[model samples]
Structures are given as C-alpha cells and as structure tokens.
Target: MDTRSLVQYELFGLWLLKRMALRFRCFAKDERCRGSSVIGLVCSWIETDLEGYRFGDNLIVGSMLDDLAPDTEDHQSRYTSSALDAVNAASIMLDFLKTRDVSLIKEIADLARDSVDMLAQEMISDDLTEAALENAIENHPLMVEELSLQEYLWSLAGEVAGSGDFFGDLIRANAEVEARLMK
Candidate 1:
C-alpha cells in the first residue's frame, strides 16, 4: 500500500482504538504505528497480555471487531460458532508475529528465555499503568523511554514489586534481599 493509504488506515485504527480505550483504558496507552493502527493495537494487546495484564478477567484477546464492524455481515464480524470464533480470533492475535506488523519488537519468548514460565503467570503487575501507557500511546513515546523490551520488562518488574500489592511487594522484597546478598 502507498504511504498515504497506510496513514489513512492507521488514522482510522487510531480512532477505533481510542474509542476502545473507554472500555479498555489500558489500550489508551499502548504503542501505535503511523502505518497501521489496527496492527498497532493488536501488538499492544499481545505484549500486555504476555506480561499478564489485561483489560479484564474475561478472555484477554476477545473479538477484534466486537465494536468496529458491527452491523456488517455476521461472517466478517464474529462467528457464532465458539470454536471458529476462537480460531478466527487467534489469527488476529497472532497477526503481529506473522507479519512483523510493528517494528523493533523482539519476540517476548526470545527476551524471556530464562523465565519463559512467567508467560503463564497471571497479570498481578502493572508497572506500565493505563495512565502512563496512555501518555505513551497518545504521545507516541516509548513506554519505557528506552529501546530494549527486555530491560523495560525488568524495570517494570521492579515497579510491580514495589507496588504495595501483596504479590508485588513480596517480589520486590525478594529482589532487594537478593541484591543485598549478592553484594
């Protein structure tokens, strides 16, 4: 697609994502692409879910077009068949990995080689709060103000560790003790 066309799509996607932010305030702070807003949103969803955070307790990756394409033919929208809907939704969820839709992101598994199991942990951490990410999303700034997603995750881990939540506090205390013992 031409640059102009891509920009148009991104703009439309931005509009849709921003509207989604009302429901999923977290989406308001995710990274975006100038060329494709839908892809941008999808990438953000994947990365956040991988970190264990989500908009809610329900399916972290729900219908991509629950609101976007309503009133359209049911086929292009959501399939009533739960299994097909899951398969179709999986395609959208994996679209980022398949197309490299966003640039500069290494696979989370690649970054989490040592602690890949964390991928299965429920999202009790929220270092990149909806407000903080919302700023980055709206301003198009890096969520960490840095490049390496790996470093950002660790830094975020520390923040989560210190967040006063029982789990987060325990993680933070453990890390500090480990640091002290190392020294």
Candidate 2:
C-alpha cells in the first residue's frame, strides 16, 4: 500500500480504538443498563471496524496486484482471497468485541495501542522534531492504551494539544449513550 493509504488506515484504526474505549468507559460507569439493545450498538460498531479493515486489506492486496506477471492469475486470486479473509477476521473480531464486557474492551484497547505504537515505529523512522515528540509525549495519555479509560479518552480527545477531533466526538457519543442508559 502507498504511504497515504497506510496513513488513512492508521487514522481509521486509531479512531475505531478511540471510539471503543469511550464506549467501554461509559459502560463501566453504569450497571443498570443491560440486554440486547446496548449489545446491538456495540455489535454495529464492530461491524464498522470490520468494514474499515476490509478497506485496509484491499489496499494491501492491491499493492501486490501489479507485481505479478500478466499470466499469474492464480497468485492474483490468492492475494484477493487473502484480503477477503482479513476482512472476515476483522468482522469476527468486531462481533466478539461487541459481545464482550468492559474488561475485554480494555484488553482490546491495549492491543490496539500496541499495534499503533508498532505501526508508528515502522512507518516513521526519521527522528521527529523535538516539538513533535513533545506533543506526542504530552498527549501520551490519550494515545497510550495503558492509562485509565477516563484519563486516556479525555486526554487523547479532550482539550489537549495534538488531539484530533475524532476523540472529542467519541467522548461526546459515549456521554450521550450513558445518559440514555441512565434514563
């Protein structure tokens, strides 16, 4: 995949992680809520994640499509199939995450953060400017998965520097859901 597409996937994944974390925080604060409706929302979010993954995987597969010789139909098909499998896996993961409890959400968030860190390291080899590094470090709470849910989401998307608006939207959505559940 091209650098731009990779960046887009990374951004989308980050957004998804942020949203999932926010949802878990809201769920943790309320115990009275239960049953299928809430579960359904989570499931839908997972589906969205799967869709994002499909787009990512397709981009990866497309990169190899041009490398194969004109007659190499089998290889091309195999990559195409593999891309589909990745999408399916993403979908299943989404479904599983939706059904799981807050604890599982925490685990997933940790995994996602690790993945993001690894991806960043792989993608950005050059030393970041001092200011950039400082910004990342300062905003580490939101970007780091290990922090408390409230702190991470709030710091990541809350009025902190370098935070994307996506984080703020996630926080707002989470609050709205919680408010609905409380009523």
Best by TM-score: 2
lDDT tens digits, residue span 1-183, model 1: 443333222222222232222222222223121222443456465445434564442233334444332232343211112222222233333443335343212232222221212211222244678676444443432222222433434444445433547355534544553453233
lDDT of 2 by residue, 1-183 (tens): 343333233323334444443433333334222222332333455445533433223333233322311232333232232222223223333434334333333444445454344334444435889678655644564344434543444343333223355446545645653453343
lDDT of 2 at 29: 35
Question: How large an RMSD does model 2 have?
Answer: 17.8
**Prediction-by-prediction clash tally:** 3, 0
lDDT of each: 0.34, 0.38
Model 2 worst lDDT window (10 residues): 63-72
Q: What's the C-alpha lDDT at position 15 in model 1?
A: 24
